[model samples]
Target: MTRSELIAQIKQKKSFLCVGLDTDLTKIPEHLLDEEDPIFTFNKAIIEATSDLCVAYKPNIAFYECYGLKGWESLQRTATILPKDCFSIADAKRGDIGNTSKMYAKAFFDPQVSGFDFDSITIAPYMGKDSVTPFFEFKDKWAIVLALTSNEGSADFQNIENAEGVQLFEQVLEKVNSWGSIENTMYVVGATRGEAFLKIREHAPDHFLLVPGVGAQGGSLSDVCQYGMNKDCGLLVNSTRNIIYASKGTDFAEQARIEAQKLQKEMQIELEKAGIC
Candidate 1:
């Protein structure tokens, strides 16, 4: 989706919520296991229940890759069923150089080749330019680069400063911005990094941010909006465990919708406060 299309959806829904489909077979309702494809079955239900409440859906790739072939099949089905109006993301934190990165791009952006086309993919910037630039080759697709992550170990590298005193994540935002326009590039800023959003905005005032680490991770939603929100409401705050795992019973989908509604209501208020609704 183009930046305008995305922004329109956020405004139309009065939300910037991105629901994470980090589906785990073991965690789903036992009754679903009886279905031919439990994962897709579960995802379809969640999508049907909450598609109107969210503007995006992110399927964490690792969750599917772990199951091998069957896992991939489930992912394909899930991708096929995703609402056309909602932005789709392959949360595949993939990074490689040259042809490898190109192939990764094709896998997610080229539906004819991989049967899984996503609006964007989470990319690790460790491999530098070559690793990330390949994704931008696909028109209208995005490269969501990892920056200040929520994980405790993120400080080990992302926080390291250079001789010029610029932190690694700061340098990443500066350099990556040069490779792509705000229309196609976004950074992964953890919601847990509340105050850090003040620093991040200094470098990327206009670029959209795909924020995770909210809900179950205990990141404050209000803090993220207060520090990170832009005029366009440039934020896609994701919630995984807290929504999807709200109930492990027959009412799982209903429970997921309730959880999503809660976030959507919060997001609507934020949009109103920012004068973007």
Candidate 2:
């Protein structure tokens, strides 16, 4: 999807919620195990239940890759089942040298290469421009660079400052923005880092942000929208464990729907408050 298409979806849905398909086979209801592919079964239910309530779905690749071939199959099935209008992302956090990165790009962006053609893929910027530039080689696809993550370990490197006193992440946002326009580039800013949002926005006010750390992670939806929303409502706030695994029983999908609805309703209010509605 192009940037304008994403912005249009946000407007039409009155939401910026991005549901995370971090599907773990061990965590899904045991009943689903009867199916040939329990992971895909769980994901299909979650997508069907929450599709109308949110604008995007992100499948974290590690969850599938750990399980080997079957896990990968589930990831492909999940991607195929997602709503067409809703944005899709492969949370692979992939980056390598130019040539290698090109293969990773083909894996996620090429429908023929990856089985699942995602609208975007999460990327790591620590390797510099060659690592990221390859992903943008595809048409209408996106590269969501990791700027400030929610993990506790982020403080180890992202927070370190240089002589100019600029945090490493801030420097990343500044430098990486040069490689792609706001139309194709995005930054991953954890919702837990709500305090850093204002400063983060100061560097790239117009680009979209893929925000995780809400719900089970305890990142406040209200606080995230208050500081991170731009004129185009540039945020894809995500919730994973909280929504998908809300219940482990037969009514799991229903429970997931309720959880997704709560977040969507909260987002509706935030949009109105920001006068973006």
Candidate 3:
């Protein structure tokens, strides 16, 4: 989806919620195991239940990749079932040598190969521009580079001082923005690091931020928007465990919808406060 279309969705839904499909076969309802593909069966129901309450869906690739070929096939089927208007993301965190990165791009962006046709892919910037630019070449797709993550380990590298003492993530944001415009580029900012939102806004005031660390991670939605929002409501606040895994029973999907609705209702209030609706 384009920037305008995303913003329009945020406006239309009165939400900036992004639901994470971190589906784990081990945790789904026992009854679903009787289905041909339990993971896809669970995902389809969850998407049907909560698609209207969210503006995007992010399927973290690790959950599926860990299960091997069956896991991959499940991901393909899940992606096919997502609502068309909701922006889809493959939180693959992929970046490698230029040639390998090209293949990764083809894997995710080439609708023929993966059947994902995701609007965005999370990419690590440690390897620098050559590893990132290949993904940017795809038309209307996005390269969401990692910036300040929400994990405690983020302090280990992302906050390290440079020669001038500027944090590493700050430099990453500034340098990466030169590689692509705000229209096609975005940064991943963890919600747990809400304090850094103001600093990030100072660096890329108009760019969209794919925010994780909410819900189960304990990041406050209100705090993130207080400092991170632009006039366009440039934030996609994501929740994973707290929503999709809300219940491990046959009513799991209905339970997921309840969790999503709670977040969307909260988001609607935030949007109203920001005059975004």
Candidate 4:
């Protein structure tokens, strides 16, 4: 999706919500296990329930990779069923040597090769430009680079400062921006880093941010919008556990819709407040 198309979806839905499909087999409803493919079954229902309430869907690659072949089959089915109007993301934090990175890009962006054509994929930029640039080679696809993450150990490296006093993440923002345009590049900014958005905006005022760590992670929605929102409502706040795992019964999909609706309502208010809708 282009930037204009994405912005249009945000306005049309009155939301910038991105639902994470970190679907775990063990966590799904017990009844679903009886199905031929429980993971895709659960994902299909969840998508049917919440597609209108969200602008994007993110499937964390590890969740399926752990199951081997069956897991991969489930991911393929999930990818195929994703709503066309909603942006799809392969939440695979892949980054390696240039050649390997190209393969990774083909795996996600080349539908004929891997049966998965995501609108974007999460990338680890520690390997620098060559490792991260391959994904951008695919037209209209995005490279969502890891920057200020929400994990406890993120401070160990991302927060380290250089001799010039610029933090590692700050430098990452500056360097990565040069590799791609705002239309195709985005940063993974944890919602937990609320006030840090003020600093991030200085280096990336117009770029979109794929924000995680909200809902179950306890990050404040208001704080993220207050500091991070741009005129285009440049944010895709993701929630996984709090929505998909809302219940473990037959009403799981219904409950997920309820949870997603709650976030959508909150997002609508933020959009209105910012004059973005």
Candidate 3 contains a number of clashing pairs equal to 0
lDDT of 2 at 135: 87
Those runs of model 4 whose alpha carbons end farther than 4 Å from true positions after fitting are none
Q: For residues 1-277, could you state the per-residue lDDT of candidate 2 as single tens digits?
A: 9999998898888889999998887899999999999999888888999999999999999999999998888888888888989999999999999999999999998988667689999999989999999988888999999999998899999999999899999999999999988888999999886878998899999999999999777788888888998989999999999899899999999999999989888989988888888
Clashes of 1: 0
Between which residue pairs do clashes occur in model 1? Answer: none
Candidate 4 — worst ten consecutive residues by lDDT sum?
A: 109-118
lDDT of each: 0.94, 0.91, 0.91, 0.95
RMSD of every prediction: 0.7, 0.8, 1.0, 0.7
Model 4 per-residue lDDT tens digits across residues 1-277: 9989999999999999999999999899999999999999999999999999999999999999999999999999999999989998999999999999999999999989877789999999899999998988999999999999988888999999999899999999999999999999999999886999999999999999999999788799999999999999989999999999999999999999999999999999999999988
Could you tell me the lDDT of residue 90 within candidate 1? 94
What's the TM-score of every candidate structure?
Answer: 0.99, 0.98, 0.98, 0.99
How does candidate 2 score on lDDT? Answer: 0.91
| Candidate 4, lDDT over the whole model | 0.95
